[model samples]
Target: MSTEISIKDAAKQLNISEQRVRTLCRQGELESRKFGNSWIINAESIDKYGLRTAHMVAEDHPAYNVNEKCKKPIALSFFSGAMGLDLGIEKSGFDVRLACEVDKYCRQTIALNKPDTALLTDINKYSANEVRLAAGLGKDEEIDLIMGGPPCQAFSTAGKRKGLNDERGNVFLKYIDLALELRPKYFVIENVRGLLSCPMEHRPHEKRGDDYPELGLDELKGGALNFIINRLENSGYSYSFNLYNSANFGTPQIRERVIIICSRDGVKPPYLVPTHSEFGSDGLQKWNTVKKAISNLTSHDHLTFPEKRLKYYRMLSAGQNWKNLPIETQKEAMGKSFYSGGGKTGFLRRLGWDKPSPTLVTHPAMPATDLAHPVEDRPLSVQEYKRIQEFPDSWDLAGPIIQQYKQVGNAVPISMGNAVGKLIMNLLKGNEIPSFNNFKYSRYKNTSDKEWKEQFSKQVLKHKESTEQKELGFG
Candidate 1:
């Protein structure tokens, strides 16, 4: 239900006159309803109007500033969306001294929440020395850690799968170059699960078939990661990476990411320790559920689905989706999509009160990836998105409501960040690292560096053998 307040309340909230509020209502600048003659405004409309009409809430502070009093190990952040990962590291005692973000709203978010951290706009415009100085360090001051995930669209399965050939891919290399130049004692890189299989060189689909020649080394799946490993290795950095699900670290979402850790001293930190597990197995806590994540909220502000989609949502219960619809209803609801392949599980789905949410998408109402609330008629709220990502409720998110959702959706789960941060502390402090062997970080196999490399080597050997037999006409 929409929250409504009198015009006087709306005017007071915006610090504008009653006449101006009514003018906005008449102009359709705010959402207003006339009940028996008096105008009542939607409370959310007031907030949105205030945010756009005047200087943003983020304008209260400087865009960037350095903290001279920071005493924790220094971490420099890049591609710092909402500082979700950095927050986790901070929990484990590292100070993120600088944040470099390119997005406008993300910069606003950084300035709003991390006023003390120096903020830079474009990484490409700065040199190693510039980045260091901005972090409040001297020319030769050692960097404790450099952490970021460069844009992953180049390697994302959902995109063109361009790998490092795209312009964004070049930036990915530059981030590593910056790390190598600054020579941080430790660094962390995080990305989507698809990076494991993206090729170093992407070949267009039309160019491949039975008539095409055998795949080149650089064109094979895993080639992209192999090239990254080689580049870091050549730079004298020893790295370890694995696919990990955020839920294992106690995040209330089943989001998986590839985390790569590189050490200047060649000391490898073990994989992240799991704080919870599916079904409470191995004596860990049970996975955090959507019900638990949002149960404390007294009210929710959310976007709504069209009446057509709502018809399907109303038919389904918690944890149910289009699969639960009757046969004819399924066809009507899905239309052409009903006959298309795959589970179509994301269609008209509702979150399960007893289960963790599916991965949070940038847009919660996308047809193929809706993240509806368990019992509500609307999609999950921005407040609920923050909670599931493990961000503190008071952590200010600045921007339009849609942009707020994108920011929260793209953040590294605070639990995942905390895990990485705790591990980094142990490694840097000379404590014995916790080791869990054969742990199912995700549902995939051969994802560890050791196993993945071995498997790739086998593929290369198999290709070579097949080529030799083909040339020799063994058949």
Candidate 2:
């Protein structure tokens, strides 16, 4: 029942000690049940259990419990959000001994799910030696990997794309330096797809046309990543990267992320091998769908939409958006955004049953990016978000429900994590796993390390030739 509460919460509501509440449960004055040792105060005992509890006790602390006696490969994680990527690596036979995160909610999540793993804050504040010590590695124990998806808002396409100029982007650069300093056998950097095209030094669009000199290398698109690659090359590391669709790796959501796998060893690892594909091409499985992900759910915890929005939702069918409504209704539903440019596909939209769900956003009910359920009159629930992200059904997220959604939404899909792990594992075992030829890694073009380098070279050459023409009166 929804009214079921936790004993800790019951103690607060009933104004009694948690011990007193436990005694009541023992004396049969209250009805309580257990899920992994945490108690759930039953709905039947409304006076004692009350409505504060949501019927689930989150004894999910040991979710990623590891055996200390067994020494798998060692890894250090930074900017670790919800440990989604770390879990994938852990499952791939790595002992993830340390995780560094700055978000308070994420720290709580890490403490809950990985009690034994060392937790740190602010990647910028810690030295490489401090990080190694925090991970509990003895002086001679070498690290196999260092991984992070640094705060990516600087390179997010939705933002102004400040790239390395932004403070957050500077921190990303710091993570890179740390990796090199620590000298892990391999290092992985996961980031938003926008990183592929972001310039190292952004120039305002208004400073363009004949008014500006030919854009320097730092100002050109893809310059930021080029700079990062150059930094690694100067340090003697080889890398391979690609923009990968999470759906291609068996995730139910169609989120695309850029994964850069680097090595202290000379040879670079291949692109992540796919476990699924669109249309099930190349003998891979078909893309997982949201309908397949949540069809059996009988109950869900969720945030609600306003009645005004619900009325329009009732008029629309699964897969329909504001465009599906009557012309007048569409205008009303979209308001001024109806007249805006680009197909506002997210406005007043309902998810399609057959298709992979859209990229999960931190907030599902934001006007321009609604993520309503296909049949229900609400946005995708936090539980649904976790399932789509491939977190286990019982993985207890920390923070309030809204914060919970943010944590899950921002997570790297676990399937993608597993693929990253598998690739690293193969490399460590001296297995060279080449990717399937001609496979589409993502919707974008020229994003692979090979393809992107060629493109960057061409862009640089074009700029060089143009500058020469201006100098020699060949223009």
Q: What is the TM-score of each candidate against the true structure?
A: 0.87, 0.87
Tens-digit lDDT string for candidate 2 (401-453): 88889989999999999999999999999986966998998998988999999
Model 1 segments more than 4 A misplaced = 1-69, 469-475
lDDT of 1 by residue, 447-475 (tens): 88888999989988988887687678762
Candidate 1 lDDT (Cα, 0 to 1):
0.85
Query: On a 0 to 1 TM-score scale, where does candidate 1 land against the true structure?
Result: 0.87
Q: Distance from true position, residue 293, model 1, in Å? A: 0.7
* Model 2: ten consecutive residues of lowest lDDT: 54-63
